[model samples]
Target: MPKNGAPTRTRILDAAEALVIDHGYAATSVDDVIAASASSKGAFFHHFASKQALADALVERYVAADLEMLDSGLAAARAAGPDPAVRAVAFLDHFVGLADGLMGEQSGCLYAAVLTERQLLTSQTSAPIATAIRAWRDGFAALLREALPAGSPIDVDDLADHVFVTFEGAFLLARSTEDPSHLRRQLGVLRALVETALAAGPQEERR
Candidate 1:
């Protein structure tokens, strides 16, 4: 737990997360974090044994926060209706709404940024990163399993993976093109695909 209104450690991690997103993990040095966080070198080391340790903590914290946000969205979706398909679509729409709000700031995902620089990450740091990705995929899969009609032709696991991949790709494209609509458009397509699949029922071809 963080001490006081904001602990020194939390401040350090926050600074590191923002810097890493802006300037790749490899480029963000301890000194940079210390300066941004307004903490002494000793204070930084007291919280983290090494830079790798700090990186690990950052990923852990980030992933946990993200999951919490997703869970809240899921809860809201469930509360929105009794129909599983409608709830699922509502969840996806919630995600789209969140992504749309991020557009004006152009703030890319921290996880995506770190994964892109995976080569620079140590084994310790990489573990949590992989866990985070899997957690997201699994979470989506569970939702699809509950939402899709029984005996539907769609592969829940595969579609879940596809959604995660598409999200990452959309972020990359949006960042590269300097256009936030790229992500919004991609999400719109995903929502449409889900609606189409639900509409088709169990008789649709497996392909």
Candidate 2:
């Protein structure tokens, strides 16, 4: 194993994630990662027990990064104000900034990459990915609760799910059209949707 074990492990993971996102999990071999990272098999095994272990580590790292983004972005966005409309606008605006930063890198969703070759993955990898995605959903739902008109008729869970839908849809369209700005453009529309929902107001109290 190399003396720079941590850097070597990170190098392998970085190379593997890129390959998996581009070519998929099944197609990316251990030797491919070793060569891509410019590390030997000794360094590889010193870090990971096997190829599957490497995949698990990749999923864990990806999920951890995503959750950090989710939490931090929501905090910054919600800091806009106490008003629901203001919060909604702030959230979307923050997301647009996020989208702009992530534009050309839209094809690199680790969850999407893992699912694209799910049969080759273990439950250890799949379960955490699902949980992380749901964390995204639930986190957005919390934002919606703060942003939407209290007691509005809209299903908060369903509305929250649309956040992911819009992102995934935007990513696909961007890829097909080679339009880098598509995501930012679509996220801009989400503010209007929230505003409309906010104005809808609470329904008549159930007797």
Candidate 3:
């Protein structure tokens, strides 16, 4: 425990994630993390054997949090409405509400940060990220399937990827421009897209 830090590992990861977001993983160093975390070198090495290990832990923590968010947002959607279409909109809406806080608290996504520096992480670290992202795709696809009418021409997976891209891009755009509203507005667009699909039933599309 050093300087208002008792939960040493979480502190390290929090600081590391911030550094990784602010600067690429290749550019960030263990000393930077130790300083940011207000942790000692002994505490840093105690939790992580090496910088690579810290990277691995960072990925795992971010991935787990992503999954939790996906699941909880889905839960919120279900609770918000009974209809699948409404639920679909609710799902995106849930994130829209959180978008500002996300923008304010952490202006960038760790996943996107790591992704641009793919070479920085080992396969073991990268695989979970890929899997978690695909999990988001699958989760959203399942929800979209329930929301869309039969014979819908839309490929849920593609639509799902669009959601992913918007979410990632929103954070980056917001961070770059120093605009929290950018995140909110981008997420609003996603909600509108879901509503559009839900409103246009499969039969209507054939017209």
Best by lDDT: 3
Residue range with the least summed lDDT across 10 consecutive positions in model 3: 198-207
Q: Summarize candidate 1's per-residue lDDT along 54-124 as a digit string, tens digits.
A: 88898889889877876866776788788878887887788778777766654577777677676645466
Highest-scoring model, TM-score:
3
Model 2 quality (TM-score): 0.87
Write down the lDDT that model 1 would get: 0.79
lDDT per residue as tens, model 2, 1-207: 555566888989988998887778988999999988889999899999998899899998988987888787678766987775676567677788889688756465667778767574546678887787798789778878876776789998888777777777787777789887878888878767877887887889879
List the global CA lDDT of all models. Answer: 0.79, 0.80, 0.84
Runs in model 2 lying further than 4 Å from the true structure = 1-6, 120-122, 202-207
Order candidates by TM-score, high to low. Answer: 3, 2, 1
> What clash pairs does model 2 have?
none
Clashes per prediction? Answer: 0, 0, 0
TM-score of each: 0.84, 0.87, 0.92
For model 3, the superposed segments whose C-alpha errors exceed 4 Å read 1-3, 203-207
CA RMSD of each candidate after superposition: 3.5, 3.3, 2.0
